[model samples]
Target: MSALQAVAKTSAPTPEYYFQEARAFFDAFKASQAIISYRKSLLMTPAAPQALNNLRLLEQSIGRMPDGVKSATRACVLEPGNTALQHGLTDALLSAGEIEHGQARNFWRHLKPEILIIRQGLPEEWNGGPCRDGQSLLICHEQGIGDEIRFASCIPDIQKRFGGPVILESDKRLATLFARSFPGLTVVEKVQRSDSNPPTAQYRPLVEEHGIGRYIMLADLQSFVRPSLEAFPRTAGYLTPDVTETRHWKDHFRATGKQPAVGLSWRSGMRRAGARHNYPELQDIVPFLKGADFLPVCLQYDMSSSERTAIQKASTKQLYIPAGIDQRNELDRVAAMIAALDLVISPNTSVLMIAGAVATPSIGLHSERGATFLGAKTDPWFPEECSLIKSGDGSWSALINEAIPYLTRMLSKGGRLK
Candidate 1:
């Protein structure tokens, strides 16, 4: 008998065997195979906690949040005491647009206070309850700069509802931008730095010095501000660019005599393995750029020498990269450049967020697995100005093919077409 047949003949294979196979497949990046194996294991051993949890994670990694929610919910039921499973379920539910679920709030119960601390002096933590007017509320930012940008959409709404002085503590890099973006609020820098961990005591001054009356985390703002889809901020371009920088870029691009200056950012800088799926090869977008009336501008922050060379060779049309403009540290310049563009085509990243927030008529490209892609193919954070286009099964070519016609229509309205 074959070795597989011999093993089957010797003994009935157990769920453990299937689980190990699933893990191996997952390690090899064969997610489809891993999912099959995981399901098979679960079929035999329905209450297997690790298998259920891993399956949920795998599903989410591939942009299957609904499936992930079901798997995580089942896992949480199987292991009722496992806080991690509960957290996973909560995240899946939130991502899948089930924000009204009571269980979603339970995700915060497991958070370490050190991660999101409230000042002891606060009268109470804001938990989807009405905030007293004129009360001072300190908003502690969490997650990433993109998320901070996303949550910042709610500030104007917060101002409208609660007649309070809003204090925002976010990444140090964003303090200046946030200050400019939201005029009325006080913006403070967070304690952590990229190079070193500052003492937690450094953050205390933000609370104590301000005499903040209440506290709320950035994500939690969604509960009160955006309880439903219609509640989202209808205005585009909440952020205002520096007029001097905007004029500089507009003049610089106009000087080139290239009609229809279209901004492009193909890659996201996030280094997580799953996040890598969100970035497509520059060549995938090259064919779309070959057409008339469009001048492609490289908005990628850290384009390497090799990548620049490759992009130069691929784009038949003239592509512009503003000399000495660092998109990473100098968002002021980046915002100005985006303001100068006729349109932007980029993946779901901070680049898209910036473009959307600036009211740029940009096309947001997302991978099949990109978390920024909501089920409706619309981003709640951005206004109608940002058009959402999703790649099927990680196929950037498919996205390009579908987007070219829509892009042509968008360009035809105002941009120069050759």
Candidate 2:
């Protein structure tokens, strides 16, 4: 038997064996497997804070965050003197969309005064701006590319506030895109630079030397002011697909003569843990599309040759438009095509985020645990028009079955279609 199966067949399972398996799965980014193994380890021995913390990390990674305050409460109950857990619970509660309360005060009581003193040094404004006149503002991008895109909208707002040019330090791949998207803003790739004259010790110091008195982390822009979905709602003709590249797709759809077309994006981040939460093999969705009069448009990034072939064969006669990763304009084209489609169905991924941003009627398939606490019908991040189809038991087939009627109802609405 394989090593994993062999390990699973242990004569008498030990805590170490389960913990090791859980670690392996977590390292592989197989979140679901890690969660299962960790739960098994916990059952073997409860009151394990390490396992609980790991599980919480996995949950956050998969976008299913419990109210930090609630988690902190449980952690406090388990170990009253665990100050670290209490502080973590406060941070978690704040991140999960809760305002500060007496619970925060209680939790803060356990934290060191020095830590709070240092935190007080930072500016209170979310943008960290409205700095001294003529001072350059350094904005650092954090987290994933999708996050960068989501917060990119804030640049114009910041520019309006800070009369001086804004310097955007971000991932190299995004530098060019940002520069092109936002003219007059200095977009630089995050890189190590050697210099003379009291040379910089770190990247942040370099910004200070460049007269960037105000520093703002990109992810924190949301805290400044909530963005309205209607201002950037998905319009039917928002983005136009490239005729030279998408002619085949256009022709294939045209041949069907007014038939319903649907876009599909099944896989997400390849990291094993991300895959477990967002990845449902293409074959799993094939059975659901069997009798539908819809064309399958692939929007996944970095698809392998075998995966491509599988999707093509499984598509039967439906048109399959292969999108390239290198094409900078591909995402816009995909968004345009998604706009034209009868509906877009996807798991939590960049494509779903984009679809939601554009106001496309989408069915977001999420893990049952993720859906239960996050919400049931609509996502707070997206407009109310966008529907959420969550799994009750985290079963792929069941979720898809539940989504069909929802898609049908959306189609019947006679909304704008390109």
Best candidate (score: lDDT): 1
- Give candidate 2 regions above 4 Å deviation: 1-47, 54-69, 72-96, 99-129, 160-164, 172-185, 192-211, 227-257, 312-315, 323-342, 368-377, 384-392, 414-418
Error of 1 at 358 (Å): 0.9
Q: Scored by CA lDDT, what does every candidate get?
A: 0.71, 0.56
Please provide, for model 2 over 1-418, each residue's C-alpha lDDT reduced to its tens digit, 9 standing for 90 to 100. 1476686677677766777787777656566677678778878877776666665656554545563344455666777766666655555554454422322333353244322212212223334446576777777655465556566666766787776867887767556546655767888776443353322224555555566656666755544433332333233221233444345555656676776666677766546544554556667677546745666666666556887788668866544655443422456555445555556777766666666545566767664323212222345454423444432225566567766666666666642221
Quote model 1's TM-score: 0.82
Candidate 2: worst-modelled 10 consecutive residues by lDDT: 114-123
* lDDT by residue (tens digit), candidate 1, 1-418: 1443466578987787778777766655566778888899899989888789898877876767789889998998888877677776776776576667733464454353334333233345766544565567888767676777777878888766666688988777667777888878898877543322321323445666777768877777777877766777666788878888888888888888857788888888867665545667777878777754677788888778888788678766745778987788777668778887888888877878888887787777765433333334467677644444442223567767777876787898763222
Candidate 2: Cα lDDT at 336:
47
Q: What local lDDT does model 1 show for residue 231? A: 74
Q: Model 1 misses residue 386 by how many Å?
A: 5.0
Q: Estimate each model's TM-score.
A: 0.82, 0.64
- In model 2, what lDDT does residue 390 have? 38
Model 1 whole-model lDDT (C-alpha atoms):
0.71
Candidate 1 colliding pairs = 134-163
